[model samples]
Target: MRNHNTLKWMIGGLVCGLVMMACSLSGLAPADTGDSEVDLQKTQLALQATQLSIQADQLAATQTAMAVPAAPAEPAAPPTSAPAEVPTADETKRVNNVNGVYFEYPAWLASDVAASIYDAPPPNADDPYFLIEVDHRVFEFQNYSLADHFLTPLINVYPLEEYQRVNPGAAAQITLLKDLISWQSLGASRPDGLPFLPIFNAAQSFFTKVEFINTDSVNGLRYLTQFQQATYPIQNGQMIYTFQGITTDGKYYISAVFPESHAILEPYDDFEYTAEFEENFLGYLMEIGEQLRAEPDESFNPGLDALDGVIESLRVE
Candidate 1:
């Protein structure tokens, strides 16, 4: 009888387990427990535990993704050529007692100045005895030019009226230049034989890169070209950059000439004075001018920009 009762109990437990599994698989509510409130609390706790487990897995996935490093970026290409260097004026020089003129030049160059009077006779001198105070500044590179003795860069400042009074031939040109400055009309071409004061005999030819510039208290025109009287070939160091300026009050004249060279030109000694060159020198000069006009400012030795910088920093009180 005891064994029979045990079998009956086992059979009842198996039926209960089968019924519970069937209810869970079919998405049906479990058969109600006698203690209704306790059964509801148990279901709530189980749901919360499952949600907490899912949230923990998601947080771990996010952290794992963040910890991994990203792929490195591709490097940029190298430049084809090094950039040209821009020069700076590191030294300031002054000409005292003559309109309080002062200018700055590149520190890399050697420079000096002299103040004197031009008592010599001018071809157009109104008064041969009339003296004009002149201040001359010279700048030179160590070993750049064979013609350094005459081709060194120079700056001269003097009274414009005195210069015009002495060289009366330049009076009209001075007036025209002043008018150009005042009106700011620079489109028209300037004629040849332009005077560079304190420098007689030579004339400026084939002006290129012509532009008007202003110093501290004056305005002037600047251009690049060679100066000559005869049909001379454009030699390397003979090419010059010059600035001619007048004070706003038209009292002082500032003149700057800087010798320059380019790879396109030949050295003075190397050039052949062939008869063919002389016959067509005009065309040759014009062609050279066109080439120089097209070249970048940085292409010239002691670049045009560096020379312009000195003029821009000039101050005449």
Candidate 2:
């Protein structure tokens, strides 16, 4: 019985010690678990903050990209304009024939002869008493009353040698006239019995008639009245004509009872004549007159007939 009790006591002591140790180990385990839980929570909070910071940085980069400006493109080029054209001068030119001949009478006639010829009535008379002719035909006769002084005479005579000798320079002019008339009258025959009488016969015929009426010779001035018949050759027959009278001075005066057309005799001063007139008027007259007379038309020659009157009216004043 004693042994059994002792065994029971020992067993009981061992059991009690084991129970205390088990309780202390359980309490320590609970404390350590709590400390580990606190550390894990802190780590989770730090990780969350880092993620938020990264998200904010990404948003800021996206905003910066949106704010920046882009560079501009270049503009297109403009078109060019064309240039203007210029004009040129004319290339063709006209030319005139210098050899052509033209003839006409003076602008004034009836007035000029009256002022120079008639000295009887008052200076202002209705009728001018003057007579003149051209190319062996009578032209005008009037009183010196209402007329301009533009009328003068251009004498055409055959006895130019005597006058030409006195005026030596006139020799060339006389020769030119004779040559012109002769050249124009080439196809026609002369009215005078002589074929070419050296141009003196025409003057002689005019002077002969004047000597018959005004036969009174005093000092160097001889007043004559009658005249002889003039002559010229033609294709069929001779042309006979006459002149009334002409003064010694350059003035050609006539009576009132003269024909409508007559011839005039006048003298000219050599110094006053121009070369243009001598070459153009005188030369052209001689050339054209011969051409007209060679044809010899009595009815259809008003213009040529008028030209005779024009020659009578040509003066150098």
Q: Pick the candidate with the highest lDDT.
A: 1
lDDT of 1 by residue, 21-41 (tens): 222222213443331111111
In model 1, the Cα lDDT at residue 43 comes to 15
Candidate topping TM-score: 1
Clashes of each: 0, 36
lDDT assessment of candidate 2: 0.23
**C-alpha positional error of residue 3 in candidate 1 after TM-score superposition, expressed in Å:** 99
| Per-model TM-score on C-alpha atoms | 0.59, 0.18
Candidate 1 runs further than 4 Å off: 1-99, 111-149, 183-185, 188-190, 193-195
Scored by CA lDDT, what does every candidate get? 0.51, 0.23
**lDDT of candidate 1 vs native?**
0.51
Give candidates' CA RMSD values in order.
46.4, 71.3
The TM-score between candidate 1 and the true structure equals 0.59
